[model samples]
Target: MLQLIIRRLLQAIPVLFLIATATFFLIHLAPGGPFHQERPLSPQVLEALNAHYGLNDPWIVQYGRYLNHLLHGELGPSYGHPGHTVNELIAQSLPVSIELGLWAWVFSLIVGIPLGVWAAEKQHRWFDRVCSTVSTLGLCLPTFVLGPLLMLGLAVGLGIGNVCGWGSWEDRLLPVLTLGLVHAAYVLRLTRGGMLEVLNQDFIRTARAKGLSGWTVLFKHALRGGLLSVVAFAGPQLSALVTGSFVVETIFHIPGLGRHFVQAAFNRDYTLILGTTLLYGALIIVMNLMADLMQAWLNPRLRVSML
Candidate 1:
């Protein structure tokens, strides 16, 4: 297992570099540069600015220099926001994004797993039907649509929290709920389906034959095994929610890496955009690796194969 983990980590190096290179070139390929604006700048000042940032160099040379700096942990300066490095901006904004992501994942698990279990337990009953209906609706709604609707329902219509602001935790209520609710629905469906399948498996039947009480059979034998699938699914889903929260954050006006990423993209801040992308890619890759490890831990057969 340790060797497998080390191998995965070693492989991630090139993936990160590839992501960085792709981000660097894609940003440059856009019609104008970070310096380009609707209002023109003086040619002399532009030339000086270009020279200062090493934009005067050929594209390949500039990219090579950028990669070299990256190797040294210098992610470059903020293009539009002077007096700030890309790392500094990420440090400032990442907390909010991380907080949102944490809450979203928790909310997803709390709501989805239980609801799925309950639905599965009560299959063909009203509770199961209701959960199915709710999950369907959540799956259907886009976060952009859901965010405003939630704001309207909770903030405007119900007047529970502020509609827009980053002043307090209350401001996060609707956004977090909005971002998490849909993911919860997905998790619920997956957990219920997985649990139900486990319940019907041969081992579950054997446990029943051994006269184990229903609860013990369900919890000790079924739930743990069933949870393996859910845990694996949750990792990727959480990563998606974390990265995709940019839209939800923008709609809700939350101060997070997501919002900052969008802002950097709009401003053509190459370093900021590439740095953020690299960070996101690294995070997702790490989470996925962790999930794989967890799966092996849960199912010893996988662990044995790895060994």
Candidate 2:
């Protein structure tokens, strides 16, 4: 396991490098500079600014310089927000996003897994149909639409929670439900499919024939194999959650990395854009690696194959 983890970490290096390289060149190729404004700066001032920030350098030179700084753990300064480094901005906002993501993730798991299990157990029943319909609606409704609708019903119409803003627990309710419900729908489908497949297997029949209690056959004998799909989906989902949803965060007025990323793109804050992109890329790789490890641990055959 240790060797496998080390190997995966070693493999992430080039993946991250490729992501950085692509993001760097693509952002640079886009129209407008970080300093571009409605009233253009005088050529003299623009030249001074360009030289100061090394924007005057060749693209290749800038790439090399950026990589060197990255190696030294320096993300450079944000152009749009004066007096802030990309690193500092990320440090301040990432925690908020992570906290929000964790809540949403937990909510999805707690709500989704049980519903899926019950649906699979009661296939072709009224309860199963209801769960199916709810999951379908959850999947079909995009976050952009679901977020406001939830705000309207729960916050505006019902007066159950605040319309927006972060801090209070009430502020968290809408955002978490909005973000979590969609993923919960996905989890429900995956779990139901996995459990249904597992329950139909010959091993399940044999377990029942051996006089095992229905609950024991379902929980002890079936659950481990049935949950494999959920385990596989968890890694990337968790990474995406922790990164924050751009629309969800923006709608709720939550200060998160996603909102900052959107702002960085609009302002052409090259360093901030690059910093956030790299952070996201790294998180994805790490999370996926962890998921693979978890999957291998859950399945002995997979572990042997990995070795």
Please tell me which predicted candidate would have the highest lDDT against the true structure.
2
Clashing pairs in 1: none
| Alpha-carbon RMSD of each model | 1.7, 1.2
lDDT of each: 0.86, 0.91
For model 2, the run of ten residues with the poorest summed lDDT = 158-167
Off by over 4 Å in 2: none
| TM-scores vs. true structure, each candidate | 0.94, 0.97
Report the Cα lDDT for residue 160, model 2: 80
- Candidate 2 vs. true structure, TM-score: 0.97
Question: Against the true structure, candidate 2 has what lDDT?
Answer: 0.91
Candidate 2 lDDT over 227-289, as tens digits, reads 899989988899999998999998898999889888899989999999999998899999988
lDDT (C-alpha) at residue 20 in model 1: 96
